[model samples]
Target: MVPQEAYRPDAGAMTTAIHVRGLTKRYGDVQAVGGLDLEIQKGEVFAILGPNGAGKSTTVEILEGYRKRDSGEVRVLGIDPQKPTREWRAKLGIVLQTANDAAELTVRETIRHFAAYYPMARDPEEVIAKVGLTEKADVRIRKLSGGQRRRVDVALGVIGNPELLFLDEPTTGFDPEARRQFWDLIKGLAAEGTTIVLTTHYLDEAEALAKRVAVIARGRIVAAGDPATLGGRATAKAKVTWADGLVETDTPTRTVLELSRRYDGEVPGLAITRPTLEDIYLTLIEAPE
Candidate 1:
């Protein structure tokens, strides 16, 4: 386990965007989080990847001030989330897996209503346009498709112009095109300096958006680093593939050079590949204590 001090310091000129130490949560006898420690910098797109019932949701809920922890130190944007003030609440945005249904309201109407809660809310029209729902802005919530409804949910989340955003499987029900569009939206928000904390089962999503990622299992962080190199993935052995066979070895360059010698210069259908995030993720989840 990482020491509590390691995850303590704030990042950037403003210090840390989020600092957590010894974060533990329990539901009856089941420990949801066990001495978790984490530090996220400002303007970073950090991802949390974990298997089902691994405490991902529990941790996020605590950070969001939706649940209380058994014992821990948590500072989100320099304030304890468990004791959120109105100002602190305004700085944070959350897109949960499921949003409440505003059945009788139009997409635009719903956004406008939610915006009223925040002191520094963004323009309702702008929020709608940003989430790519301008075309459906007039449609009632009960009449829009699932994907469109999800967009409305996102619109509400960012309506406050929050400094940090929490996205929990934001694209779970999206189709391919919708997912791609949503990714772009997230990128735009991050580019504008919104610190984002994402939790998703999609390894591809984490690889595409997260500047850094943490993998959790059994309520503990097993690995945390840049997605490309987590679990020594970038430095790990490469798989050299040819028309007839494949070989996995640490020295892929040497293997390719040797294959060239046998093939008299050019090996047929030759390609070298390294383990993908998905591959590493599955292995990490399946490994035993």
Candidate 2:
């Protein structure tokens, strides 16, 4: 695993995959997005996090060409999404938060149907296998478990062999083990050089899958950086706790050593912790504009 600190914005000479400048959208009196600017590098797994009505959904929809933006420049895969061509659309894949309407088609049949839409599609059976649905390839969509049907959703998304994939809460209803399996599948896709844009409410999911994350609130980005370092979290003071005492300090190691010496051995119930990604996210979103 790459260390979290290694995900700095300027770590490499990266190519741009998606770029937006001064993006804005308004819904009557409420501004859904306001002057948002972002850039995602090729092959990077980037996450956008926010509560409902924070404009993340609007931003993502604009990038996906599902919604029109009022103003600002936007480019996805080097083409303006506003004027997307058939060829450009073919290069993208999307896995929405909700699964497609419950289908009667079997896994293999569904994959094959979507494969026909792309110019260079992966083999249907191969796509099914890639999503760990080989055993369920012959099963009808309505017959599979929730997690199994989710795997079918993923198979359809990837069958197009897209250069970029947008996953919107891909594991929303998944159990722990199922979520882990999904993460592995996503990692495999990222390793194959597919740029991924993920939107998830689960902070741990963002931390596990995204190299970098942007926190949006009230239609603006309040924080954007490596997940570990967002909102200065990486440098935040650690809280050192023991059986009867606790102290917050920049030098947690020194505090632990002192506690050990005072106790003449290991400190009882000793623990050290920094602010988690969730902790930082809460602060960012709840802060005043």
Candidate 3:
């Protein structure tokens, strides 16, 4: 049942899917989250990147209503998760690293069972097919491969027909093909107006799936923006490389032109490159505390 006061999208909370300001959470002497701020729009695929213990878990848990925040404002779907209501919870889906251990049940049985809990669930068969589990729909959960099980987790996550989805390393056990398939599924979900909040260690996955990303370091956001240009990667020095050596320069075009004139055509083994998301990620994670 949708709560009139809580479930209205136009409740005048500034119209953001998820919003946070100065969020802080502490555990004794260790501050798990310190002054974090985030804003995710409707239908946006937002990714969070951080090293281990970088407050992603704490921050996200607070937002999900699984943990209490020590201070600051937090809102999800125009409702304060801190004081979550059934209607607010019904609008959200969470796909964690762990899944149900109902090994004896078949995939169809599991999905159908989970779907029963939501008032507005998607068709169980359609959910299974969307997660690439159609071939294994009748297979026992225990009989499935790790990747296939992960797909099941995804299926269960979205079966509710949620307005927002939290994906914590959703493709952990996926093979290359499975991972690509999952990405497509996520893209499809986003295209249909699902706001996805994703947390993953895989930089390429973040770059591929996220429209915007926030890099958390030392319990705070260090850098956030378009994945291609995060941390000034787009304007960062480019390296021109050849068989002999490599040189870093601001004007890679000019350097390439000089090298081209020097070689009179293709500079042997020549390549011009800028920092990749992974490169910038490494730097962001390794920055001095």
TM-score order of candidates, top first: 1, 3, 2
User: What tens-digit string does per-residue lDDT give for candidate 2 at 31-77?
Assistant: 99999999899999999999999999899999999999999988888
Task: Tell me model 2's lDDT, rounded to 2 decimals.
Answer: 0.91
Q: Count the backbone clashes (under 3 Å) in each candidate.
A: 4, 0, 0
Model 2 TM? 0.92
Candidate 1 lDDT at 10 equals: 38
* Location of the lowest summed lDDT over 10 successive residues in candidate 1: 6-15
**What lDDT does each candidate get?**
0.90, 0.91, 0.90
Q: Candidate 2, which segments miss by more than 4 Å at Cα?
A: 1-14
Q: Report the Cα lDDT for residue 20, model 2.
A: 90
Which structure is stronger by lDDT: 2 or 3?
2
For model 3, the local distance difference test gives 0.90
Task: Tell me the alpha-carbon RMSD of every candidate.
Answer: 4.1, 6.4, 4.1
Candidate 2 lDDT score at position 157 = 77
Q: Write the per-residue lDDT of candidate 3 for residues 1-31, one digit (tens) a residue.
A: 8778785547555558998999998899999
lDDT of prediction 1: 0.90
